[model samples]
Structure formats: C-alpha cells, structure tokens
Target: MAELLVAGGGIGGLAVALAAAGRGYRVTVLERRDAFTELGAGIQLAPNAFRALDRLGVGEQVRERAVFIDELRLMDGTTDEVINTMSLGTAYRERFGNPYAVVHRTDLYQPLLDACRRTPGVELCTGAAVTGYEQDADRVTAVLANGERVGGDALVGADGIHSAVRAQMIRDGEPLVSGHTIYRSVIPMDRVPEHLRSNAVTLWAGPGWHFVHYPISGGREFNLAVTKDDGAREAVTGRPTPADHVLAQFPEIGPKAGLLLRLGEQWKSWVLCDRDPVPGWTDGRVVLTGDAAHPMLQYAAQGACMALEGAVHLGSVLDCDAGDLPQRLIDHNYALAPRTARAQQVARAMGREVYHPAGVAAKERNAEIGSLSQAELHGKVAWLHHGTP
Candidate 1:
C-alpha cells in the first residue's frame, strides 16, 4: 500500500485521509493549527456528500448534529414573497439515495476526526506547518516550517485557497480575486425570530447584494452569509469593516435578516476568488484537491460537497489499483476536471445572478424562476443535487 501525506486538515484533506486509510494505506494529516477549529460558517451537504461520509462510516453521527432542510426557498427582496422553491427534502431523497443536511463547520469535522483516530493506518499531527516539498522518481518529502521532514509515497494538497503545493505546480498562475467580498456570521436560534427559523434555505436577492440563511446545529442556531460587489480594492488590502458596516449595506433585508445580523456574535469578511481550471491536478507524486484545486463562491452552496465528492472518487480510483501509482493519480484528476469545471461555471453564473443582476432585470429573473415547472427546476440542478458514484 502507498504511504500518503495530506497537507491541511480541512474537510477535503481529512476525507482523503479517510479514503486512504480505508484502503489500508498509511496516512498522515499535518495541520498547521495547534488545535482543530473551524471558522464561523455552516455548510450544506447534499446527497453526494452524505454518500461520501457514509463511505467513511460517519454519516449517522453527522446527521445527529445537523439540520436536515427539505427545500430551497428563493424570495423577493422587496415584497418578502416566496418566489420559487425546490423540494430537496423528500423529492431529493427519492431522486438521489441520501438526504441533504446543514451543519456548523465544526460539526462536519468532528465525526471525521473521531473516525480517523480509530483507524489503524491513519495518524493526525497538529501544529505542523508544511512549507514546501521535494519530489524524486520514487518518493516525495514534505518540508515543515521548523526544519523537519516527512516522507511518503505521494502528497495531496487539500491546503485550501492559499495552497503552497499548488503554487509549486503552477509556477506561473495565481488566483484572481473577483472584485467581490462576502460577509458571514452566525447567531443562536433564540436570537432569531420564530417565523424565519424553518427547514428551508432562504435567499434574498437584490441588486448588487444577496443574503443566505439556514438553520444549523440541529436547530440550535442559524448560519448567515451576505455577499456584495466591492469596487477595486488595492491588492493585499487591510481588514474589512466591522459587522455594523455590513449591516448598514442591507437596510432592505427586512426584519428577519436584520435580526440575524444584529444578534450574530462574530462577523468577518472573505475576499471571493477563483482560478481558471488547470489542465492537470497532478505532477509526479503530488496532487491537489478542494479549494486548492477549484475555489468558487458560496452562491452554489456546493463547496464542501464538491470536495467530498473529489475525495471519494480519488480514493475509489486508488483503492482499485495495485500498480501504476502515477497513472492512477492522473486518472483521478482526469475524472475530476470535467466535474469541477461544470460546477465552477454554475457557481460563477449563480454569483452573477445574485450580485450583479442588471437594473430591474432582477425582478424579471425572479418572476421567471417562480414560474418554472418542477421538471424545469429539477433539470437546472440535476447534475449537482443528484450526482452518481
């Protein structure tokens, strides 16, 4: 079996470790942080992601801590009317084979960690920062920030948007920060008004601004995300404005949205960024996954799901092969590129629709969406909501 090293302990890297360990490969995860903690946010895991977690035997634990939403509700910003809705609750389960769920970022990480701790071939090392790597014909070695070295048969960069290993691969390409910024925060369920806390993902779309909110942590809290177009900020800019400044931008979000922002305990800004699809995700013994490979805006709500799918597919390819290590890695990337590209395109389009809808065009678009037949709505998201193994 191959010895694998995964840099970064985010969802993608941990999934890779789980996939590798299941196949009896020796896997080590090196995380730079001293303790495992996720930033403020919630992620939606569709059926595909649930199937992937099921492969690791942690699906039940995840479900116990997450909120299972049945539908996605699109609303009119001015009228506060439900424009359109998709049945992700029962309909999705019938179409796909699993349920969609929402959870705090930490809830998603904990069960994966527990499973990794129990697996014999899996090891997790914290506070270990990977600085660079050296690859030869037969093996790869990761150099730690403190002058330590770890050797393995191959390396996977699940290190996220600021990947050091991805940097080494491109040598010439860098991520372009789309001139947009997202503000995020979460609040306790008690803080949210009773009318807004339901098993639906509510989205408010308006010109140059949009808001997303959903119940998470088994209905104990609500996750909130706001995105707006920011005119050209200088590269390497300073910190974003405080939560109050963010609240000031959304005076039209109505009572529920306003209440959520007023009650959120912490808030932060993230510069939205993405890159053109790379021709390949592997070179020799190193490969890339997740945001490191294809970062996209949250409008699609598939970031974690796509990463989960990639990990499962990568593991399945490797698990079925006993020889030709490099070719197997190449095949993994080949299978993933098309899928990631399509998802990226959809994400970009969704971002434009939500934040850059032209003039009064947003109203017309919302009307069209509300008038869509079930077949039409399902057709638009079939690729994402019902992915096959």
Candidate 2:
C-alpha cells in the first residue's frame, strides 16, 4: 500500500487521513501539538460539509453530536428587524441531500480523532512539527523540527495558514490581515435567556460590525462570534477580552442584539487574516490543502467546509495507481483551486456587502435580502453547497 504523510492534525488533516485509509492507503499524521484538540467554540456545517463528512465515514458520528438548524436569520443590527430568513430544516435537507447543522468544534474534532484511532492503516503522532521537506522523483520525506525524517510516497500540507510545508514549497509571504477583529465566546445554554436561546443561526448586521450566535454542543452551549472593523492587525488568540470591551464595540446596536452581545463572558479575540488564492498548490510529491492552500474570511462561514471538501478530494485523487502520484497531486490542485478561489473571493464580498454596511448601503442590502424567495436564496448557494469533488 502507498504511504501518505500528513502534516497537521487539524480537522482537515484528520479527514484526509481517514479518507486515505478508507481507500486502502497507509496514513501517518504528525501534529505539532502534544495532544489533538480544537480551540474554537463552534462551527456551521452546511449540507456540502456534511456530504464530505459522510464520504469520510464519520457522518453519522457528526450528526449525533450536531444540532440540526431550522433556519438562518439575517437581521438589521440597529433595528432588530429580520431582513430575511433562509429555511434549513426539512426543505433544505430534501433539496441538498443532507441537513444543515452546527457543532461544537470539539464535538466535530473528537469524532474525527476517534475514527482515526480506530482505523487500521492510520497512525496519529503528536509533537512532531514539520520543519521542512525533501522530495525527489519517486518519494518525499517530511523533515521534523527534532531532526527526524519520515519518508512517504506523498506529503500533504494541511498545517493551517502558517504552514511550514507551504513556506518551503511556495515561499509565500505572511497571510494578509483584513484589518478586522473578532471576539468569540461559548456559554452554557442555561446562562442565555430563554428569548436568546435560539435553535437557529442568527446574524445581526450593522454599519461596521456584525454579531452571530447559534446553538452548539448538542444544545448544551451557545456560540457567539462578533466581528468588527476596529483596524487591529494582529492575530492574537486566547487573550481574555472583557465583556465590557466587546460591548463597547457595538454601542449603537439594537436592544435585542445588545442583549445577546452582553450575555457573552470571558470573550477571546483574534484578528482575521487570509491569503490570496494562488495559482497552484502542488510541488512534486508535496501538496497543500485547507488553509495552507486557500484561507478566507469567516463572513461566508465556509472555511472549514471547504477544507473538508478538499480533504475528501485529495484522498480520492491519491487512491489511484502509484505510478501517477505527481500528476494526481497536480490534478488535486486543479480540481480544488477554482472552487476555493471563488469561495475566497465571495467571502470577501460578503464581508463588505452583507456583514458590514453603512447607511444607504445597509438599507439597500436589507431590501435585496428581503426580496429573495426561498428558491432564489437556495439558488444563490447551490454552487457552493452542491459542488462536486
């Protein structure tokens, strides 16, 4: 069997390993962290992401832990009026062949990790940071920080946005900062008032900021994320941001939106950053997937979904005969680049047009959203939710 070495034990890397192992390949995953853990609070998995999870053999596990959402409501932050609502219940499932759901990051990550552990041909190694790599005509070897070299038929760089493997292969500069900051928190569902404990994903859009909240962790917790254009350009993580500091950013928000924002405690903030879509992501036997290949803003909430899709595609392409390994990697890049590039572009557009708008522009956005019928709303995202690997 062919050996596949994956750098990074994130959701994307583990999904890739599971897919590869399912296809009869021996897979080894190296994670920089000593233990596999996800830091974020929650994630929204549209039907497209669910399709990828199902193909990786973890769909049922994910579904058991996920909270199936009924609708997505876009509201005017200053007026507390919902501009539009998209149905995500049975109609959505019937149309997309899967359900739209939200999950705690750990709830999703743990199952992938457990599946990896149970798989026969998959190996999970921690504390192995990939520093560099060496590759030739036949095989590639990932160089670890501790000076160990692991050889494999192919090396996959799923090491996230600051990927060491990408640094050696593409030599791209630092990721571009969006001059936007986000404060995130997850609180016990019981802590949220009954009125605020929504079973749906709700987004409040204002002039220069937006707030989103949803039920996660099997309805035990609520995940809140607030994004604004405060021009902070540093990507700080896990720093305790006071609830007051978060509230201060949205002084003019409506009472309903304010109530949700004020409910969050012990918020953590990070500066948003992404890279421009590159022309290619494959170099010989080494290939890039997920954030390493195409990082995007969270406005569209498709970052992790895209990563999951790419993982399945990468594994499927590599499961073929060994003689075409290099070409197959190139094919993987070609297959994924266009869709991810479009997603990146659309995400940026959504930040400007939908998430943060001012005065007349905001009104116009509301009008546009309110005018969309259910079919039109579904058609707008058909390309993304129904994309093929």
Candidate 3:
C-alpha cells in the first residue's frame, strides 16, 4: 500500500488522513502539540461542510454533537433593531441536502481524532513539528524539528497560516493582519439569561464592530465572538483579554447586545489575519491544504469548511498507482485555487462592507440585508451551500 504523510494534525490534516485511509492508503499525521486538541469556541458548519464530512464518513458523528440552528438573525448593534432574519430549519435542509449546525471546536475535533484512531491505516504522532520536506522521484521525506525524517509517497502541508512547508514551498512572508481583534468565550447556556437564549445564530452589526452569539455544546453552552477595529496589527491568539476592554470597544451597542457582551468572562482575544490567495499550492510530491493554502478572514465562516472540501478533493485526485503523481497534484491545485481564492476575496469584502460599515454605509447595508426575502437570501448563498467543488 502507498503511504501518505501529513504535517499538522488539526482538522484539515486529520480529515485528509481519514479520507486517504478510507481509500486504502496508509496515513501518518504529525502534530506539534503534546496532545491533539482544539482551542476556541463554536464553529458554524453550513451544508457545504457537512457534504464533505459525509464523504469522509464522519457526518453522523458531527451531527450528533451539533446544535441544529433554526435561524440566522441579524440585528443593528447600536439600536438593537432586527435588520434581517433567514431560516435554517427543515426548509434549509431540504434545499441543501444537509442541515446547518454549530459545534464546539473541541467537540468537532474529538470525533475526527477518534475516527482516525479507529482506522486501521491511520497513525497520529504528537510532538513532531514538521520543519520542511524534500521530494525525489520515488518518495518525499518530511524533516521534523527533532531532526527525525519520515518518508512517504507524498507530503501535505496542513500546518496552518504560518506553515513551515508553505514557507519553503511558496516563500510567502508573514500573514497579513487585518487591524481587527476578536474576543471570544463560551459560557453555560443558563448564564445567557432567559430572553437571550435561542436555537439560532445572532449577529449584531455596528460601525466598525460586530458581535455573534450562537448555541453550541449540544445547546448546553453559548459561543460568543465579538470583533472590533482596534487598529492593532500584531497577530496573536488565545491571549487573556479583560472584559472591560471588550465592553469598551462596543460602547454604542444597544442594551440587549450589551448585556450579552457583559455576560462573558475569561475572554480570550485573537488578532485576525489572512493571506492573499496564490495561483498554486503544490510542488512535486509536496502540497498544501486548509489555512496553509488559503487563509481568510472569519467574516464568511468558511475557512474550515473550505479546508474540508479541499481535503476530500485532494484525496480523491491523488492516485499512487498512477505514473504521473506530480501532474495529478497540479490538477488538485488547479481545481482548488479558483474556488478558495474567490472565498478568500469574498470574506475580506464581507468584513469591510457588511460587518463593519460606518454611518451611511451601515444604513445601506442594513437596508440591503432587510430587503432580502427568504428565497432571495437563500439564492444568494445557493452556489456556496450547494456547491460540491
């Protein structure tokens, strides 16, 4: 059997491993952390992500732990007025062939790790930070920080936005930081107060700031994410941030949204960053997937979803028995680049015009969102939700 070596055993890497193993390839995943874990709050998985999960055979597990959201509610942050609402209930499932849901990042990661563990041909190795790679005609060798070398048929760079493999392959500089910082937390559902609790995703948009809260942990907890234009460009994650600091960023926010923001404690902050999509991400027996290939701002909420899509496509296209593996990788790059690039560009646009518009632009954005009928709203995202490529 052919062997596939993957760097960075996060969601994309593990999903790729599972997909390859299912196709009769022996897969090994190298993770830098001491243990496999995910840090963050909740993640919204649209139907598109679910389709990829279904193909990887973990859809049911993901669904079991997810909160099936009923609606997506948008409100004016300064006035607490409802701007627009879209349904994500049964009708959405019927249209997209999969339900829209949210899950805690850890909850989602656990099942993928468990599934990888149970698979016969998948191996997970921690404390193995992949430093670089070298590929010859027959095989590719991954060099780890500890100086250990592992050889396999191909090497996948799933090491995230600051990927070492990407550094070597594309030679891109540091990721571009968007002068915005995100404050996030997950609190018990009961702590969210009675009137605020709902099976929906609520987004409050204001001038230069936005707040999103949704149910996660199977409806037992609420994930709160607030983004603000703090004008700080340093890229940092999981850093301790004061609740007062977060509150100060949204002084103009209305009462209800203000209350929800105050409910958060032990908040962590991450500076948002992304890279401009490139023309290609594959070189010989080495390739890139997920954030390493196309990191995007969180406005669209499709980073992980796109990664999942790319993983399935990469696995399906790679054939060890084929005489032209390099060309096959090139084909994978060609198939993914256009779609992921569009997503990346769209996300940046959404962050500016939709989430953080100011004054007149904010009113126009609200009017545009409020004007959308149910069918129109669905139609706007149809290509994204229903697309397989």
How much lDDT does each candidate structure score?
0.80, 0.91, 0.91
The pairs that clash in candidate 2 are none
Where does candidate 3 clash, by residue pair? none
Q: Of 1 and 3, which scores higher on TM-score? A: 3
Give lDDT tens digits, candidate 3, residues 1-389. Answer: 88889999999999999888987889999999999998888998989999999988899999999999899998999999999999987777899999889999987788899999999999999999999998889899999999999999889999999999999999989999999999998899989789779899999999999999998998888899999988978999899999898888888999999999999999999999999989989889899999999999998889889988988988897645635667888999997788889999999999899888999999999999999999898888887788555
TM-score of each: 0.94, 0.98, 0.98
Model 2, global lDDT: 0.91
What's the CA RMSD of model 1 in angstroms? 2.2
Candidate 2, TM-score vs. the true structure?
0.98
lDDT of 1 by residue, 228-286 (tens): 77754533322446877888777776665566556665677777777777769898888
Cα RMSD for candidates in order = 2.2, 0.9, 1.0
Candidate 1 residues lying further than 4 Å off, grouped into runs, are: 232-241, 254-256, 320-323
